[model samples]
Target: MKILIVGNGARESALGVKLQEDKRISKIFFAKGNATTDNIGQNYFESDIVSLRNLAIQENIDLTIVGPEAPLVDGIVDDFRKHDLKIFGATARCAKLEGSKAYSKKFMQTYNIKTAKAQVFEAYHDAIAYVKNHDYPLVIKASGLAGGKGVVVCEDVLEANATIHKFMIDRIYGDAGIQLVIEDFLEGYEVSIIAFSNGQKLFPCIPAKDYKKAGKGETGANTGGMGSAAPSPEWTAENQIDFEKNILEPTIFGLQEKNLNFRGFIFFGLMVTKNGCYLLEYNMRLGDPETQVLMALLENNLVDTIESCLNGDDVELKFSDKKAVCLVICSGGYPQNYETGFEIKGTDKVEHSTLLFAGASREAKRIVTSGGRVLSLVATGDSFDEARDKVYADALPIHFDYAYYRDDIGKF
Candidate 1:
């Protein structure tokens, strides 16, 4: 089978590695892939969705998998299906769950899904007034996609005013902030559960925990993700049962009731609190650094699992008992201003962990930083300590100008 993966990041890189394990897969292709992916499959440097669909048809791709949210939300799957191309991803209408926070919040409310109370606003004055009346420590989020950097936790009216001004007035996130969702902050640790859905049932993968803060000790602004680990320490068997019953089943039922034929990944961002788990947000596809670690712990053939899910067959996803850890190496000043093009070294020397490139390109036969979050090193072991040790030991040698990484990953 020939497979085409759409995206150009570490998550796509990891997908390539996992898909390759399926011996039935004879060829792999990437759409506008990065330096790391170039080494794993045939890279097609194209960005247009129509052209990508044509490429899939041209290559006779048996299945095309989408790895990024932007394209999926933009209707890539819809476009492909229109041409009778087999693709894996949610339709644009269904993607609204991730593309628009306001829309998703409404969906949750309608389905009675457990989530924080929130109000959506379109006017600056209305938002300001709403914030003034709300309690402190509110979460202000852009209605549209902001690459995971749209939400901010405001501690006071002053901060809330500034964030609202930045998102609505200053247009920091452009049209993404044309509207915003102001919600009460849910206090708890976060767990990311990605499930394979066929519009009816769900096959949940191992829960993952990711550090979004750019600085150590959870300081600084949020980035794509700093680091991550699989089998989140916060996820208990009881939590699993509760999630499947209260969250997963309801989500599937809601999709079916809404007539949304979703056949792709459903990412649930949950905040486990003393009260219970509250849904934070929904993502149409897999999370970045989280994917790096989950791919390491997954023992099932990804292609088979996805196909089985799409067929609505009873498929049990298998995962390694070993714990996995991922440490992200980034260009300094990431999730904000930072320079790229710096030559990356020691990637070839890292032997203790697996290297998945996120933001890098080849120049003069050498790899150089091309984006903020560059790559991730993932390691798995019987224990989290062993995985963390392996990941850190291998992460030490990688170098780039102004490169930085969090030191507290997998500390739990």
Candidate 2:
């Protein structure tokens, strides 16, 4: 089958690599793909949905898989469906789960999902008053997508008021900050559970723990993702089943009840504490660095699984028992101001596993940093520690002028 993967990031690179390994796949194409996919597939022109759809029609591409949320939330799948093309992603309406936080919170509340109690506000004064009256240590979140740094965990009333001002009054995240969700801070260890849903049926993948903080020991601002590891030991089989019953199932059923047919990857961000699991947020597409590690441990044919979902069949998703970890190498001063175009080197000597380029490109024969998060080094092993060590070991070989990476991942 000829498949076209969208986006130009490490997640798309990893997907391209995995799909290339499937013997059934005859051709691969990337629209606005990064330097990595250029080595594996036919690189198409830049990703304009209209041009992409035209190319798919002209090339007779059998499948189109989206890698980012922007296009999906912008109605790419709906456009594809208009042309009678088979595409993998949620429709624009279903994408509200990730596109707008206020929509998702309202959906969760209406469905009685296990999430923290919160109040949504469109005005600064109302939100600030709520924060001042409520307890300290609340979470102030932008009501729309702000990459992953929109949510601020305020430690006290002073901090909460500051965050509220920044988000609502100052408009730090632009219009995305025009509305805010002031939620009670739930103390817990976080884990991400990603599932492939076919509107009616849901297939859960292995749970992963993502390091969102830009620095080590979780002492920095959140980025898209710093690193991640699969088969989080904390989320055992029992924990998985409980989460499935309480969180995932309810979410799927709730969407259906609301007459929303959802597809693509549904990401459930959970906070696991002594009081049990609390839903934190939802992502409509695959997580970034987390996808790098999870795909490394997946043994199933991704093409077949995604096609099965498109065909309205229950996908029997399968995964390897091995543990996998990925370490992200970011540009210096990431999640803040940083320079790009610095040439990177020494990836060929890396052993043990794969290297997926995230935000990088070929400036002549040399690869240069193209975005904040540059590349992901992934490795698989029998244990999480061994996998993490192997990932870091492989990452050591790659170098750039001002590369940065966290020292600890999956330690919790």
Candidate 3:
């Protein structure tokens, strides 16, 4: 079977590698994929939905798996369906779960899901006034998608006002910040739960901890994600059960009640505090660095899993028992200003691991930085410590100008 995967991040690279391992797949194509993906499949045209659809038709691609939320939000699945093409992703309507924070908050409230208290605002003055009236340390979020950097935690009125100004007036996140959701800050251990669904049954993957802060000791602005490790120490079976009962089940049932045909991956960003799991946010597609680690430990064929979902089959997803860790090496001034196109070196020395390219390209046979989050080094072992050590050791061989990464992922 010929397969087509969308997006050009490390997640897509990981998916491409896994799908290529399936003997049933005769040909594989990546839309706007990066350097590492080129080793796994035939890199095709850019990620334009129309061009991809045409290519799929011409090549007789059997399956198209979307790896990012942008095309999903732009209605790529809907467009593919129009041409009677089989694709794996939620429709634009179901993608509102991540596209609009206000809509998600309202859905949570309607379904009695455990989440932080929040208020949505359109006008800048109203949002600022609400922040001042509330108290200190609130989370200011862009109602629309902002590549995971839209949410800012304000420690005081000054910071809150500044964030509001940056998002609403200055338009820091483009039109995504036109409206905002100011939420009460909740403190706890954060974990990400990515699940597969077929509008009927839900299959949750091993919980992973994402290091959002740009620097060590969890300080600095949030980028896409600096690093991640699977089977987080805090994610006990009890906590998993609580999450399934309190968050996952309710969310699926709520979407069902609304008559929304929710399919594809559903990501739950949760803060597991003493008060139990509280919803932080939702992502429509797989998490980036987390996907790198999780896919490294996956023992089954990705094509089979996604095809089962698309076919509405009663499929049971499985994963390896080994622990995994992925470290994202980014440009020096990430989540802000940074330079790109600098030639990268040292990848040749990496052994017994996977290096999934995320913001990189081949410049005259040499890999170079291309985006904020550059590449991911993934490793797996019997224990988290072993995996962490292997990942860092492998990362040592890869270098580029202004390469920055967190040193304390999974240390807690």
Index of the highest-lDDT prediction: 1
lDDT of 1: 0.90
**Every model: Cα RMSD to truth:** 1.0, 1.3, 1.1
- Arrange candidates, best lDDT first: 1, 3, 2
Arranged by TM-score, best first: 1, 3, 2
Pick by TM-score: 2 or 3, better one: 3
lDDT of 3 by residue, 222-275 (tens): 889998988777788788888988998898788788887756888899999888
Score candidate 3 by TM-score against the native.
0.98
lDDT of 2: 0.86
Off by over 4 Å in 3: none
Number of colliding residue pairs in model 2: 0
On residues 39-148, what C-alpha lDDT tens digit does candidate 2 reach at each position? Answer: 88977866888999998999899999898888888899999999999888988998888989999999999888899999899977887778777886789899887888
Clash pairs, candidate 1, are none
Q: Number of clashing residue pairs in every model?
A: 0, 0, 0
Per-residue CA lDDT of model 1 for 74-164, tens digit only, reads 9999999889888889999989999999999999999988899999999999999998878889999999999999999999999999999
Evaluate all candidate structures by whole-model CA lDDT and list the values in order. Answer: 0.90, 0.86, 0.87
